[model samples]
Target: MPDAVVIGAGPNGLVAANLLAYAGWSVEVLEAQPEPGGAVRSDRGVHPEYVSDLFSSFYPLAAVSPVLARFDLAAEGLRWSHAPSVVAHPLRDGRCALLERRVQETVSGLEAFASGDGAAWLNMYGMWSRVGSDLVQALFTPFPPVRPALRLAAKFRAAGGLRLARTLALPVRRLGDEEFRGDGGRLLLAGNALHADVAPEAAGSGAFGWLMSMVGQSHGFPVPVGGAGALTAALVSRLERSGGVLRCGERVASVAVRGGRAVGVRTAGGESVIARRAVLADTSAPVLYRELVDEEHLPGRLLRDLERFQWDFATFKVDWALTGPVPWTAAQAAGAGTVHVADGVDGLTRFASQIAMGQVPDEPFALFGQMTTADPSRSPAGTESAWSYTHVPQHITSDAGPDRITGRWDAAEQEAMADRIEAQVERFAPGFRTRILARRILAPTTLQAMDENLHNGAINNGTTALHQQAIFRPVPGTGRPETPVKGLYLASAAAHPGGGVHGAPGANAARAALGHCGLRTLLHRAQRI
Candidate 1:
């Protein structure tokens, strides 16, 4: 019997297994897919020469995650390559707003749109830089019991700690409008908030916008040396080196519980594995509670919470193998890792509203990524590999089926959506369509089928809204990883600090399990033993 059995070999699961192994426990990870990394995998099926990042590409959070920082991925063959400019939001006209790593340069670019807004932007960063590391450490670590945060707050009191508190509650739309006088600056901040499921008008979205903008300026949106898979490869290597065992192609059917305590798991293949210490589930709460555990075994309140679990907006992804670089009207756009293609704030708001109403927008707000431009090894020489993603409603109104997803779109419909996105890009990248060699489109349904973790293609696991955050996430009795069940823990994005490639959930789960087993002292003893 393994000391611990972690179900899933996604980044979080792998990280959990590694932490357990590091603690001197024999750890085994069971993954349903043939390969690991969950949504962080790369694929050549989209196009032969073009390597496509199936899900997440950029890694601003990973760059600063304390859990990841401890592992030192750079030594494990992970190389981060950044674009000259992190992101660019192109308007319908030829004008564009670019975010660069140099704070002064970014401020200078903002000055064209708003005179003093440049100074305002720098001031925001000044505050962020002063307390940003501490804030990130506090968030990405386990839930604070008011002590660590209070201590950090006291330390950073001179750096506008109270101002930061107010900033977190401010509506992103209002903050953007108040800080920047010009359309370019306001749209840039608004565009960053749209990266997640948060609406611009929502409170707590301002913090996300500010953090993303600051992180972009601090560490330009980075891609791995080869592809997104490089990051996964580094993680897997680190886990293996730390003595973590990964068993792929093994699907977990159920968590076996006795006396209201999880003890082991039954696999879909009818194999049973008992964990001597703990079981960490790096999957969605709905999957854990409804599918994996017996309904009769769960508390009445927990079952009710599962019934009310909210899903975020779905997404549609399009990948292209270009014959050459995207022909851009603005030369600066060619060097950007991320490009926001929409009219402006009004256009984005309209797009969001249309998505909420279950209708595809007439002019969708598309986020295009220049993968090969960020990392040349992603494609062949002289050609560019690119992909763009846009949000859509979670439920399919065209079909009233229980699955909530309609039939796959015909080729014409897929091409039409792709054309609409390209047309938006053409506003900045004039001759974009002329360079397309091959194209692949993935609807929200396709993404859900690819990774069930993307429930209804809700990429960030669950909604990023304020109500579901921090201690309230995934139904919040205990902010720690421990579930109501004694030996079970959540190690997925549905936990605190939410999604991105950060490994905090996994680390938190392992730490909690260690405490439950009284292995914290044993771990320390073994160090001397």
Candidate 2:
């Protein structure tokens, strides 16, 4: 019997297992898939000579995650590489707003659109720099008592506390508009919010926008040296080095409950792995609450909350094995890791509204990743490995069981969507169509099949809307990782501090389980006995 059995081998699961192993408890991780990393894995066979990230591609959050920082992935064979420019949002006319690692360089680049907005951008950076690490800790860490925020506030006087409170409440759209005279500057801020499902008009969006923008300035949008999977390889290596055992190709059929407490889990292979102390589930909340645990076992209100869970927008992913680099109309865009292909702020807002209404935007605002530019080892020299993703409504109900949700894209339709995205890219990069050697498209439905953790292909797990964030995430009970059942905990993006490549949920869940399991020495003795 393992001291702890962590179900799922995502980043969160690995993090939780590592923590337990480090604490001197015998840890075992059971993963459904043949490999770990969950959404962080990459594929090379999808297209010959080109590697593709199946889901998550960037690492802005991972660079700052407390759990990841402690591990020092760089030493574990994870090499980081950044684009010359972090990201570039191309306009209709060929002008672009680029974000660089240097604050002054980014500000100067924005000055092309607005005179004083550059200074405003710098000022925002200054403010964020002071409390940015604390803010990240507060948001990524657990909520309710928000220990990081309280500690940060205590360090400052009463006035500083009030200022922080006011800043938190300030609308991001208003802040962006007030600071920047031109639409370019405003769109840059809005682009950051679009990284998640959060709308630019949302109250907390401003904070997210500012935070991401500042993070870009602090650390460029770095990619792994080989592919996104390299980061996962490093993580697995560290976890194994810490004495954690990973068992892949093991599908957890159900969680075993004994006396209102989760004791262990049963695998689909008819094998039972009993946990001596706790069971940590690194899966979506709905999966744990509705599928893993019996409905009758859950509290009434908690069940209702799970029933009312809101998933964010689904995505259509397109990966291309380009014959050559994307021929960009604006040369600067070719060097950027992320390219926002929306026309402007109005165009993006219109797309957002269309998604809200459950209609696919005719002119979708796509986020493109120049993988070859970010990491040359992904493909053959002089060629590019590129992938782009666009958000669509979660469930597009039609006569045939929800078109978007079912991922019923025939070959023609798949090619059509790919063509449309390529055309969108061609708008900024002429001759882009000629560069495609082979292409693979993943409809929302396909993504769900690939990783059940994505639910309806909602990347951030559930929507990052105001209603589902922080303590209200998944359910409004104990914001900690603990579920209604004793010894069962949620350690996925479905939990607090929400999704991203960050492993906070896993770390948070491990801490919560540790509290229940007792101190390091006690857990060790209990395991031995």
Candidate 3:
């Protein structure tokens, strides 16, 4: 029996296991998949010579995450590579809005669109410079982050606290309209907002959009050298070095409970792994509550709250092994690792509105990735490994495009959707289709099949909407990792600070478990020494 059993070997699970193991608690991590990394894995599935990230590729969040930084993954054979430009949102008329790693460069570019827009961007960055670290620290730590929150509140008060809070709470669209006279600065915020499920008009979208934009400016969206799996490999290596155990293909069937507390888990093969101290689950909140644990052990309020759990939008992805780089009409886009394909802000609005109305938009706004540009090791010299993803409704009522795609993601529908996505790419990169040597389409069903936590193809665990976040996350009345059941912690993206490659949820769970024996405080003391 280990001191801690982490149910899932995804980044979160691995992080939790690593922390526990480092604290001298024997840890065991069980993963259902044949390999780990979950959404963070990569492969040469599209072509033998090209490495395509199966799901997530870029890691701006990971770059800034204090949780991941403590591990010093670079020492464990992890290397990060960045593109010349961070992101580019191009329009049909060859105009582009670009995000450069240097704040001044980004400001200079935005100034071209409107005179004061650059200042507006700089102003936001200034705010970020003041409170960004503490803001991010507050977000990553357990909810009700008392110290960081106080620090952040102090910083905000100096900058007109209530006024700043109102701006953060504004919708992305409204924020853009208020701040910029031209569309360039606005487009960057809105595009980044779409990276989550939030639409431009959605409340509180401004904060996320601004956060992502500032993070991109501060830390260029970087990819692991070689492939995304390298990051996972580093995490695994670090865990092993700390004496943690990883068991792949060991599907946890049920969490064993005794006296209203999690004791261990039973594998599908009838193997029992006992956790003397704690059981930390990196599975989806729904799966953990509905499937892994019996209903008899859960509080009635939790079950009722779970009923309203809303998943983010489903995703459709395309991976390509290109003969050459994407031929973009706007030269800036060619050097960008990630490109947002939409005509303009209005076009993005149309696409998002269609998804909101349960219709697949005719012109999908694709978040395109040039993996080779970001990391040369992803493919051969001069060749490109590329991918793009767009949001779709969980359930479809109509098709806003010609293909009439219903909710059923069959082969024909997948091809049609792929074609539509490619068409959007080709609009920006005219010769995009010609450059594709091979292509693979991952529909919603395909994504869910690949990773069960991406329930119904909804990424981010659940919606990033204001109503489902923070204290409201996973369920109401609880914001921390502790579940209603003692000795059980929710370490998945479904926890507060939802989704992204950041390892906060996992680290929080490990600390929570360490609290059982006052190890967390002792560990901090040791670290200070």
Q: Which should have the higher TM-score, number 2 or number 3? A: 3
lDDT of 2 by residue, 313-360 (tens): 888889889988887777778888998888787777887877877776
Expressed as tens digits, the lDDT of each residue in 1-529 for candidate 3 is: 8999999988999988888888888999999999998898999899999999999999999999988988899889999999999999987788899999898999999999999899999999999999999999999988888888999999999988999999999999999999999989999999999999998999999999999999999898999999989999999999999899999999999999999999999999999999999999999999999999999999999999999999999999999999998989988898999999998888888999999999998999999999999999899999999999999999899999999899799999999999999999998889889888999999999998888999778879999998988899988877799997899999999998889999999988888888866776655732321
Of candidates 3 and 1, the better by TM-score: 3
The parts of candidate 3 lying over 4 Å away from their true place are 523-529
| TM per candidate | 0.94, 0.94, 0.98
Model 3 poorest 10 in a row by lDDT? 520-529
Per-residue error for 245 in candidate 1, Å, reads 1.3
- In every candidate, how many clashes are there? 0, 1, 0
| TM-score (C-alpha) between model 3 and the true structure | 0.98
Error of 3 at 228 (Å): 0.7
41-101 per-residue lDDT for model 1 (tens digits): 8889777778989888988888877777777788999889887889888764666788977
